[model samples]
Target: MFKILFQLLAISAAFVLTAPVNNSTTGISKLNSQQYNVVPFGHVDLDDYLSNSTTFANHTYLSAPGSQNGLERRGSVHACQGSFTKKLCITGSNAANLVGALCHSISVALEIQSGNHNCADTGVHSVSDQTQGTVYYKYKTTGKGCTTTAEPGTIEGALHKFIKEKNQDKICDFVCIRLTHGGNWSGYVGLGTSQDAVKYSRCDHEIGSWSACVNGDKGDR
Candidate 1:
């Protein structure tokens, strides 16, 4: 009887040790779900854009095209900033890679805005084709409220200082600038591969132009 009882207890201990842990409590869930891989841009606080009174209904998840392959799964997070009335989207093949890419991109944007014109210029004109990867600014407000001098050289110096101070990589593949009617501004800087960067840059430029025109602001070429 004693031997049998001891065996049963040992089996129970093995089961307890081998059972899967509850990730909900540990906060380290497996990254198997498609939704888990998609996230908001790092610099922007998406929650701040959402309303607490509402049920947070302005977000969606969509599968990325060409992610049919099992190993290369891709997903995107589409969200709207209710307060600003702006839409933001982010996509990635993997969550970790996407976060890293966003960090690098936002860092570049901040560096450029800090008066680093040279770095911003290089990123704006890095692609081989002039038509491709062209970076430009768009004014959001009308009537030319600000007529600052075009200090490209001074801006370049500031950008260089930003890179040195921030320890950022010199190479950039994509850049975007957004100006709001309230004088608030934002940018997206991406360090994707040459091909991906050019694509994103072109798209951002077009979108920026459209937004500026719609808001009665001049588009910077």
Candidate 2:
């Protein structure tokens, strides 16, 4: 009897040891483990950077009252010229920075959608307009320049939290970026269409879901 009992115990131990390891509870899997390849923007021609662009409306307006007098003064404002949009023309060096920032934003959005943490600390800040399905994210940071590294996992929980509260189909059509310089002033990098971003990054498949989330899917259900 003693010999039989020992044999049974040994078999049970072997079974426990040979059983496959379960990772479901730990939450580490290939589906959620995909890595994002983030690359910096090199020297890009400003001419080929944007697609469709509109000219800034030239206008003349009265200046606000200044300390000099309580009367409003007339002023003339001249708009930027060229095939490129006025906004991009005014951005200067910040244009390249905006491109980098946009790439980071897309990566964060992808991670969040994939059930990963929000990568907020990636220096991509966002503001959403549910009415128009438009969202904008500004990139700014201190100590670390725009080239700072993003955390491996998501760090912007609030951003993801906000995204979750909204209807996926109503997501913004354009994810605009506002690049900051000197910690105070900033400029807008307006690319013609979200497709411009797709072309620039060459990550169409990677950003496919995010594109749908930004620009509502108009396909037949």
Give lDDT per model, in order.
Answer: 0.25, 0.24
How much is 17 displaced in model 2, in angstroms? 38
- The lDDT of model 2 is 0.24
Residue-level lDDT tens digits of model 2 in 1-221: 99999997875542221112231335433321122122111110111111122222123222211111221121111111111111211121223223223334544544343233222232223322222222333222223322322221212221221122222212222322222212222222222222222123222112212111110000101
Per-residue lDDT for 37-146 in model 1, tens only? Answer: 22111111111221112221222222222122221111111111111111221222222232332333333334444443231322322211121221211111112322
Candidate 1 accuracy as lDDT: 0.25
- Residue 191 error for model 1, in Å? 6.4
Name the candidate that leads on lDDT: 1
Assess the local accuracy of residue 191 in candidate 2 as a C-alpha lDDT between 0 and 100: 25
Q: State candidate 2's TM-score.
A: 0.19
